[model samples]
Target chain A: MDATPVPETTATPDTECHTTHGYISDKARYLARLKRIEGQARGIHRMVDEEQYCIDILTQISALTSALRNVGLGLLDDHLKHCVVDAAQLGGEDAEAKIKEASDAIARLVRS
Target chain B: MDATPVPETTATPDTECHTTHGYISDKARYLARLKRIEGQARGIHRMVDEEQYCIDILTQISALTSALRNVGLGLLDDHLKHCVVDAAQLGGEDAEAKIKEASDAIARLVRS
Candidate 1:
């Protein structure tokens, strides 16, 4: 394995110096999911505005929360598969930082 | 305690025949919070559209999810304080159904 980091000049303009993150490969899919999530949020706002039943509103909030959770989990999976794996292959302080960061994010996800 | 149900004609129009919910008192506040949540969802969608960093996006998603969770919890609390209490006072199948509904909603919140 080549230990040498790729030169910044050779890196793609879209990614800059930092290597492309894992989710980029599924960018369109993520955007579509987020779009639907945004619509769900808007729908909730409208429901509240219209004075819908509390139980019904709560149900919608649960659904939205679940949707967001799924998105978060998907992103985490991609990050682990790509970014974490890449860092591990390189093997150093960067790998440790990446692992720690991922762990912290996982904790937040769990606790949230 | 007056076990007699309030006459439908005497009940307030805003609540119809049903008693006013606990959250009704804080309706405006809930609406405001939901509006902000909607904006947060939109912001997340934009971040993904712009291809922001995955970790940063995850952080925002966490925050959004937490916000929704809080709203769900608040609604549940209100439901318990008002709807469930009312049902319990009535003492029948209605009470059992209310308790079951509340438990189901709580489970959804926890799993989400």
Candidate 2:
């Protein structure tokens, strides 16, 4: 009797899950981080409204920026490792496009 | 000499150089930081090209995010302190616009 399990297909699907293929596990973590960041942003708004000291407000804003950027980096990493790598392994037009897309994304981030 | 050097006019101008009034001192720091962040971003690109381990790439990206965000926060803080506060003190449509602009910026960051 045949006992070997069938290998999952590596064919890259053109679907919505492309960038999120391997990031599902980290979804909760990402969401939680975003919520905290949102709260931090609101805190900054309050500081501004209250006319708090400039230095104090700046400090909080700095922290909020750190939090948001961290999340972005996390997502970018996930997309690269799972989606881009997977597509590359398939080795075709899709691979080329994926790599180029990632490069462009990086360029945009660097510019910002 | 007058006991107090003539107080620079708080009158917000309709001309350029509004947001940068208080941030000039930090210009060098910001430039250095942006250069480092740019290098880090390029490094990520190299890692992907080399097909490095996913975890390693993620770690580096995470660090880069922190660095970039810190810079952004610094700039935002400066803008709020120098530009927004000054405008608010003057109290007019300009102040309202500045505050609204900052709020919109916060919202964008949170969404990101």
Candidate 3:
């Protein structure tokens, strides 16, 4: 066998696989959501400090979770639209790997 | 001052900051959700390949995003319940760092 190792990574993103999904496009929106989440977290901390009722704290937690969820959904949308489709178009190990990787990410997220 | 730097990281998790939240507790449930998400993604892929109507594809996309959002919510719940609370109790740089880290995570998730 030849001594040279096979090339695994391409020199540039192949076609639609720019790798950067919609991050640039959605940056402002995402940052705003995170700022809101941060405030929510801090507010929850205050509630606990003041010994607020349990149910009230839980309700706030629920809202915080919902906000975070919306953010995740936005990112996932971008990943599917750009990364997955681009990789799929390439139709090789990269394509297969992206598909599997996406599913694995979902699994990890679920269990996180 | 001695050449050695300050001991930034604790030898073990300080008090409640076990670093793990509800992942272990809800592992099975998360996996089930991911499996459903994977199916949803694949179904959407098939619809696109078969040239389904635009609205139908959009609906699937929305559903897939929502499924992913739910996973994020579950994880965030666990983090707040365990990791965040644990860190807050410690009441020091470590506590501050964890709180910041969680917010940063939310930011990153938004921009992902």
Candidate 4:
């Protein structure tokens, strides 16, 4: 028993696996979204370098902003669906903490 | 080797453990940050309930926004330090993906 590394007793095994899945998927999606955003950012940089119209540059920036917001929302959704839900299921301080965290994230996202 | 579970053939084992550590720490910090944000949010709710001035509510809301941004920055820092760094060390699609993802997150956070 001493030889076996006891996994940290943070959350249940099931919850950990579920949460891990959500995180893994989120990471994958985030990477894909980022690659597209990179192209967009580079395009914006090129536009500025080429002395493109101010409105055009602004428009590209706005699009980039929206794209980024989408990624954030995606991450937020995963966090809620997996992490917060698991924490809530566990109940007590963990749940309360997750709820508050989600609230803060939502507040920030909406405010932007 | 067959029974050992190839660990999904993702990032290296050392990288995985390091990234996991960073993620775990971030989760703890995020939960703490959220708890504070929650109190602020509840205070805002009470202010609204009491028919407090709009500017006051807005100011509280602004504070909340800053708090959320700080949390986001914290997550971003961890992601860059762990995920992005690990991925980059591997040198390939994975690294590129992490870089792009980090860029998107940074862009969104700054835009907000």
Candidate 5:
């Protein structure tokens, strides 16, 4: 509603100033891995276009999937070490939310 | 070695004549999917390059991984329904080898 007062606890410029992703420190490395992953994807498409052996195509798919899984695991690790840990130290609803979010991400990764 | 007689059981032009991949029938569909996957991979790389949120990037990675898994599963299904079945009908060393190869591929998919 237009009459509703803004929550004092809501994030503001001051609080948001320090916010940076956990992966920021390793951004270059992540970028490079992602670049390679893109190339792998392109290679798979090329192989399929060429009508190469099915098993060989599957092998490439497995490799690309592994590469993605590794990157996801690495990002999860970073998130836990930085974002989740920081939130845990603060100890509140945000911390609980962060943990739940992380758990969901893990489940997605495992199922995928 | 040059003087050794060629084994009659070895695959010859007649035996190789009928060899074709299981996915040949669905080649167009698979190509389309792989093309989309390649684009997804490129998009993820761009997200990283642009410093998008870590969790958001992770979400994209999960989606891409799932896409690859589905493709792998589909290809495996085709192989079992076609190549493996054909080999199985022959009922000999080749059949056994085909089964073993499929099992190995399944293991790789699960591990990946």
Candidate 6:
């Protein structure tokens, strides 16, 4: 027997995993938002470097942090609405497992 | 002024926004995992209800929390690798915007 054993396959059947055109568009939109934030981050960096007002820099940082959390929460919402529910519908351990996984993740997000 | 102002047209061109077959499958898998966790959560609840040891309940909760965070991180990873990167390649402000958004979210996650 080959020393390199094939990993046991999970409940998931092998299927295509590419993002759909629609998902791509949404992603594109999300990315655009991210890019702007990136610019803002760079601006923050510059402000820090230039010894700008501490309060102003801190304010920007706070906004930046909030913006990031929003993005994460939005994505989490989408995943639950789409992925977790769908898996549950399929019936079996896979579905239940998925739900538990999501709940756990949500719990973490909340705590975080 | 009409109370419901038409939302400002953002850069995103509205398109069909549904998860593709592949994405659906992945989602299905994730959900299954979540369901298992749900059972675990319920078990934890029961343990608490029954007045089992506090340490045990706390331990289970901790494990559950960790599991949830892992799922979130996994989803986030996939989004960045696929969605965010794809948007950047398309050019314009969109790409940069997406990256920044993700970075902010990451910062928050780390802090949490």
Each model's lDDT comes to 0.74, 0.54, 0.52, 0.66, 0.74, 0.61
**Mind giving the per-residue lDDT tens digits that candidate 2 earns over B1-112?**
2121121222234522255445556666655554554455545444444444333444554555566456556767787778788888878887786676677656654554
* Candidate 2 C-alpha lDDT tens digits along A62-89: 5555554665567677878887888888
Mark the regions of model 5 whose C-alpha exceeds 4 Å error after superposition.
A1-18, B1-18
True-vs-predicted CA distance for residue A96, candidate 5, Å: 1.6
lDDT per residue for candidate 6 within B2-64, as digits (tens), equals 565787743244211112322344797789878988888999989989999999999999898
- Docking category of candidate 6: incorrect
> Residue A3: error of model 3 in Å?
46
Candidate 1 C-alpha lDDT tens digits along A45-94: 77667666667677778888998999999999988888888878877877
Tens digits of per-residue lDDT for model 4 on B53-94?
A: 999999999899889877776665455445654555555555
Write down the TM-score of model 5's second chain: 0.84
Clashing pairs in 2: none
What count of clashes does model 2 give?
A: 0
How do the residues A1-112 of candidate 6 rate in per-residue lDDT, one tens digit apiece?
7565788743244221122322343697679878988888999999999999999999999998778767667666455434543443454555446544544554456565
* B85 Cα displacement, candidate 3 (Å): 24
Candidate 1: regions farther than 4 A off: A1-17, B1-17
lDDT of 3 by residue, A1-112 (tens): 3222221221223322445444446666655555555455455444444433333433454555555556556656777777778778877888876676566555544443
Least accurate 10 contiguous residues by lDDT in model 1 chain B: B2-11
lDDT of candidate 5 over A24-112, digit per residue (tens): 89999988888788777777777767766666677778888998999999988988888788878887777777777778778888888
Q: Which stretches of candidate 6 lie over 4 Å from their true place?
A: A1-112, B1-25
i-RMS, each model, one decimal:
13.5, 17.9, 15.9, 12.6, 13.2, 11.5
Q: What is the interface RMSD of candidate 1, in Å?
A: 13.5
**Alpha-carbon RMSD to native, per candidate:** 11.5, 16.9, 16.5, 19.3, 10.7, 15.7
lDDT of 5 by residue, B21-102 (tens): 7888999999888877877777777776776666667777888899899999999898888888888898787787777777
Q: What is the clash count for each candidate, in the order shown?
A: 0, 0, 0, 0, 0, 38
